[model samples]
Target: MKLSFNIALRFLNSSKGQTFLIALGIAIGVSVQIFIGSLIQGLQIDLVDTTIGSQPQITITSTSDDKLIGDYESRLSDISSDYEGVKHVSPSADGPALVTSDEENYSILVRGLSFEAAEGIYKTKERLVEGSLPENKNEVLIGTTLKDESGIQIGDEVDVLTSSGENQALTVTGIFDFQVANLNSSWVLTTLETAQSMFSYDDRITGIEMQVEDVFLADTISSDIQADLPEDLLAENWKDQNASLLSGLNGQSVSSYMIQVFVMISVLLGIASVLAITVVQKSRQIGILKAMGIRDSAASLIFVFQGLMLGIAGAILGILLGLGLAYVFTRFALNPDGTPVVPLYINPGFIALSAGFAIVVSTLAALIPARKSSKLNPIEVIRNA
Candidate 1:
């Protein structure tokens, strides 16, 4: 084995230009594959984050006519204890409300929540564009769109009429921008107690909102939660709610895989063709060695070892080049806000996979040349010469 490897190294060393060219080809192929794969992954992550990052991936709501869930505290506890993926769980009460300011009236979604618990999902505190989260009774946070449309601001009182025929004057303590136009325009966030009082629900909530550790796994978790719940309670997931978005994401992934596969095929064919040519170029040396009684098996191993060494060098170079390209792209591709339009999401596992994939493909590509070299006619070569 050592002898074959040494011979392989010597053969590659003898043709420095050829070796470098082959490695460069492999490097370019690997780098392109890595760049595309990383870009697609980052785009998918950003899309998912923008869609549901600060929202409930799963929700438990009642199907009864009143549309309110009683014993929500016990339900919250059960959900938290039963599922490890349930990262944040909060009870909420939401209903339609209208704000009458001057001669204009604006329709809004009045959601009552425990800010401390809701913080994990909504990130209301972090997303605050003004003032602070609602801390006092009748104090609430309005969305940016509402603030602009109604010309309302901190310290201003908003007179709200609820669907349940109750009226209250809410003090604006803060304003938040969820980045979703609808949410920004319509959400009037307040305390859970305030909502219950306004809606005349003694101790009940509209539903239980939850965020999971893995957003993709929400469907399975929601199904499991539904199976265990009573008939009147329904568990819903974001995947089910936004079917079109899920379909679009799936299509993107399929396209990305197809591109990667085609790239790999092209690289493999290049390596195989080069190695086959190498065999013909070194035929005389191989024939002499075989005539001297070096076994065909040993002869075959020479090309295999050469392939492996080339693969190692190419894989390392490719990884570095790919990483550099990704970094450069993110740095230059800016959004109006100075953030990368496509943020770099480096997955170490994926980088390792790409390197391993290139190495394996390269080694396989040398097999054709190795087989041909093993069958070289030693006697015929010398006689012809």
Candidate 2:
């Protein structure tokens, strides 16, 4: 084995130009796989954070009616008591409404919440970019996007009309910049009492939002709540609410894997081509080794070792390059809303998988040439040389 490895090392050192080319090919392939994988993973994390940060991890709503607001507070309270993972539950009333200022009018979603109960979950007061959260029933907080479109500022008075035909003038106590495109553009926050009064639905709520102690257990807890709740109420996890987005992100991840596989195949083909050329070029050397009583298996091992060395070298270089590229991309890339994109985490599993893939491809690439070297007849090879 030592002899085989030494011979392999000698060949590699002797043919510096060829060894470098093959290693470079493998390095490029591995780097691309790593960089793309990181990109996909990063996007998936961002999508999940954006979705879950803005909305509840689980929502309990009425399935019988399209609108969420009604006299289900008693049922909600009951479910809240029964669920084990439920950390905090806040009942919300949501409906379409119009906000009008002297200069502009915009349609918006009005959500009513119990300020104290919601603070623990949504942290509404902390997220307020300007002014304070609503202190009285008449005050409201609006998203920054809503305020900008209406040309309104903190302390400005605006007329709001609910879908049920109730209208009231509200003082904007705060402007929140969530930095999320979907949330910022359409939501208006107000106290539960104020929302009920404006919508003329006192003692009713649209839905209940639950914060779970364990996010990973959300599916199980949501299922438990659904089974215990009335048939009319539906419990949904964050993934269920944003199925399309999650599915798309998953598809992107799968696509990244496919790209890595394709890269491996391409690199293997290049290695195979290089090995085949090396065999033809070293026919005389193989003839001399055979003449010196070297077995076919030993001769085969020599080339296999060479391929393994090239693969290992290339994979190491690729990992470094790929990680650097991913770092650069994450540092510079921006979301649609112009915020710095958070980096995608590169797990150890991915690195191991990439390395294993390179080794496998390298071994496979040497097989044909190894067989050719093993089959060379000393007499014919020496005469041809």
Candidate 3:
């Protein structure tokens, strides 16, 4: 085995330029694979973050009793104790309300929540453009779009008309920018008590909002939660709410796999052709080795060793190149605030998989050439020479 490896190394070194070129081709292919894989992963993460990073992965709401959930506190405790992925279970009371400012009325989604629980999912405090989360039932936090459209600001008192025909004056204590235009334009954040009082619900909440440790497992967790709850109570997950987004992500994955498969085929063909040419060029040498009593198995191993060497060397170079490309992109691709457009998180497992795939593909490409070399006739080759 050592002798076959040494011979393979010598043959490759003998044609240094050709060997380098073939390795370069492999490097380029592997580099593309790494970059594309990393890029796609980053994009998917960004998309998920934008969609649900500050939103509940699972939401529990009542199908009966006009959006009121009975014994929400007990239900929340049961869910926390029973569920595996449960991170934070926040109770919220939300309903449409008419907000009147200087004789102009705007319909908004008035959501009542506790700051501690709301912050866990929405990170509302972090996104506070001005002031802070409402401290009491009398104070409320309005979105930036609502502030701009209605000319409302902190310390301003606004009249809210609830669904039950009850009206109350609430003070805006802060303004937040959720970044989503619809949320910014329509959401009015208040306290659970305030929302219940306005909606005429005595100690009852509209629903329970929840965040999970694994966002992708929301569907399964939600179903389990639903099964554990009353028939009137239903659990909805992010996956169910964002079917279109999931479809798009699936399409992207399929396309990426297709591209990778084609790239591997191209790399395989390139290595195979080069090895075939090398076999023809080294026919006399192979015949001489065979005549010297080298087994066919050992002769075949020579080409296999060459393939492995090329794969290992090329994969190393490719990984370096891929990392460099990712770094360059992160540095150059920036937003107005100097943050990266898409964050690149290189997974070590993914890198290892890419390297392993390249190595295996290269080895397989050498099989045909190895078989031809093993079948070579020493007499015929010597006479032809």
List the global CA lDDT of all models: 0.91, 0.83, 0.90
Per-residue lDDT for 119-208 in model 1, tens only? 999988889988998877888899899888889989999899998778899999999999888989999999999888878888999989
lDDT per residue, candidate 2, 221-295, as tens digits? Answer: 999888877778788987666678767877897888889889899999899889988998888998999999999
The segments of candidate 2 whose C-alpha lies over 4 angstroms from its true place after superposition are: 47-53, 64-90, 95-108, 114-127, 148-153, 156-170, 179-186, 193-204, 210-225, 237-251, 330-345
- Give the candidates in order of lDDT, highest first: 1, 3, 2
Candidate 3 backbone collisions, by pair: none
Residues 27-88, candidate 3: write the lDDT tens digits. Answer: 88888888888988899989998999889999988889587887888888888899998999
Native-referenced Cα lDDT, model 1: 0.91
Winner on TM-score (1 vs 3): 1
Candidate 2 residue 343 C-alpha distance from true site, Å: 4.7
